[model samples]
Target: MIFMTVICTNGFSRPNTDPTASQQRTSILVLNLMPNKQGTEDQIISLFEETNLPIALTFMYPKSHVWRHGDQADLAENYVSLDDISDQYFDGLLVTGAPLEKLDFDDVDFWSEFNAIRDWSQTHTTTQLFTCWSAQAALYTDFRLPKINLEDKIFGVFENQLLGTSLPQWFQIPQSRFSAVDRTDVLNCPAVSILGDNQATGPFILKANNQNTLYVLGHPEYNADTLSTEYYRDLEKHQPVKAPENISLTAPQFAYAHWRCCSRYLYQEWVKQSFLLKENNSHEQKQLQF
Candidate 1:
């Protein structure tokens, strides 16, 4: 098993729990699909630290895809192969977005492996969170929805309004994708609850059965300059992109990230709900025994 230890030092402390005692830790597996695996890892670790939940985060990479970003040797040493962890169950699963939004789901290099992982998640994980392309893939694979290609890339900080749920009212999140899930297709899914959405971006967050899974279309965990970095990279490549809204392209250094607050809230809520569901299920099993 890939073990991850992260220290939470953001003023939140668990004073009641004894340091020597074997506290129950939430096990979360992250399927890292981003080319910049290190960057994505850092972002998630930083965000989860605020929740103060004891988390054993195992990083999983697709063995089928030819990794191109970091040294293969280093990745092998640090991360677990997706196939190796397929049999193991976890309290939570997080699937990151890849840059393969334009390609059909079946056309991606690691599509078969991803599909297998998706199948494993249905029974293995208590709660699953799918981001960006992964979210689109979930909608397509699990719900038989089609991903709609946008006229232009949705690359900016857009507003998302919560749909009268336990989630926060409204927030802005960074979006960088070539395609989006059809709003109509999502509405047809009987098990999904639209937690949040945006006018331009269609749907932002979809919760399956209010407990099993969540799909986030935008990158809420994005750092302040993630959008700026993408914009500059696109500019260098001459890939027709625009500056992120509410951020000054002339001076991105001074821009503040307001999304981190909501992002933390989203994850914290998921972790909290997952634990509650586990506890409730355990209690139900105990009752059945009697």
Candidate 2:
């Protein structure tokens, strides 16, 4: 059997020429909230590719959200709305981070719609993975946890200690966020487990809902220069952003990706766990019929 990444946009046909082979591929729906749509697609697809998993991808965006960075026509053509896939069930759901950290969750324009999609995932998807802001958002929506604005953005790569047995003892992850969930609240919560954390970045990874949902507060899928690009972009926009910390001083323009190994391991584990959960659920349903 050949293993390849098959990416299909909304209303688009699967590119896998072999119809029978497509039936065996895992389906993952990505809610791309990042401003750079294509870039985020490449990063996510790369992670799955490294796992060597035969998967079919469907990219979707909130219809309530207005296009700001990319072309509206392109997004309308390439992305699906939550309503479009209301009847479908996915093996996995990936929610990308947005740049709206400073605003309250209720203040975001698509806040209601975001909650709708999040609610839908509870029943429609087997496993859900939330990154960065979406991670914080999930904590808020489910646990009543509040996000605290950092005095300074937690920008740059930092080594995180794994709190669970799923990953290595230590792994570096790239963080670029203006806020974080309260560690005390997470510690007090009963539904969630802190999987990985850093002293500076608080809880970097969390799992809840019987490990069916995963939250990553940093960008593990980030490329080597993602942080550098953000740093320079902020400067150009005259945003009050500091130079990313923990990067080489002499060559700040290029940041090395010390997090790729951990990133791949994380995604691989998630996919494996997702498949197991799906199978177990399917078996449970069959038993219920008897």
Candidate 3:
């Protein structure tokens, strides 16, 4: 059985609770696909912090040496493992993209583990969010769509994501690198909807399966310098890379004007919609007392 617990540290302070009236908060499992455990945790935790929603976070890693990158041993210092979904049924899931861009996901050793998690999530999780590679993984698992490859890596804040009428309030695409392995023909699935897209960014943000699974093709959970760090690191390694175009290093002097406003509106709308979920998802672990 999976042991259940809340990630309480930093500012996540929980006091005495009103058992009956308490809301059941969402459990977000950061299936950190990035091999660098510590770094990935830093990037992912920020998203939960932003939501201001009472949440419990757990991290999962693929075991065995099958196509793993970075170093999992280093990540083990802070990471934890669990065996089952009974730990606590989650309301949402966040899956990260990995650095492995050159291999087919199915060929990778962790493919089966990811497949199992994806399958379990469909019925167990209320909503799921996949980032970059995980987005591709989920797309393939649920709909058998493959990611399209690009000759050039799409880096930086190239604004193409937009919020539509149906978008939730808490949804926001923070500017980051959207290095996609490929694209899939989404037209065949009526349950899938695009929240953000750029021919350059591909499907930057999207919602699938009646909003149960929210798929973000980019890394909005990234820190301000996350893109810059990756860019500089790649350049140092002499790997092919590009600068993120049109993001503010300082306060804005010049802006895209129209595109900026549109993106802002999309973010605002998401925040509005997200509030309700935040309210409803905050739950107490034990049964109501009063």
Candidate with maximal lDDT: 2
Q: Is candidate 2 or candidate 3 better by TM-score?
A: 2
Candidates in order have lDDT scores of 0.74, 0.79, 0.55
Q: Rank the candidates by lDDT, best first.
A: 2, 1, 3
lDDT of candidate 1 over 1-290, digit per residue (tens): 22233432111122123343323777788888889987887788877877777775778888888888767777765677766676777778989999998898888998898888888887788778899999989878787878888768887867666556656556666789989877787888886777777777888788766347788897867887788889989899998887777677666444444677778778888887777766776522321110
- Once superposed on the true structure, which residue ranges of model 2 sit more than 4 Å away at CA? 1-3, 9-21, 162-165, 209-211, 249-257, 282-290
Better of 2 and 3 by lDDT: 2
Angstrom error of the Cα, residue 233, model 3: value is 0.8
RMSD of model 1, in Å? 6.3
**Cα lDDT over the full model 2:** 0.79
Better of 1 and 3 by lDDT: 1
Error of 3 at 189 (Å): 2.7
lDDT of 1: 0.74
Best by TM-score: 2
Error of 3 at 25 (Å): 3.7
Residue 36 accuracy (lDDT) in model 3: 62
Candidate 3 Cα errors over 4 Å, as ranges: 1-24, 65-78, 82-88, 161-184, 248-290
**On lDDT, who's better, 1 or 2?**
2
Instruction: Provide the clashing-pair count of each candidate structure.
Output: 0, 0, 22
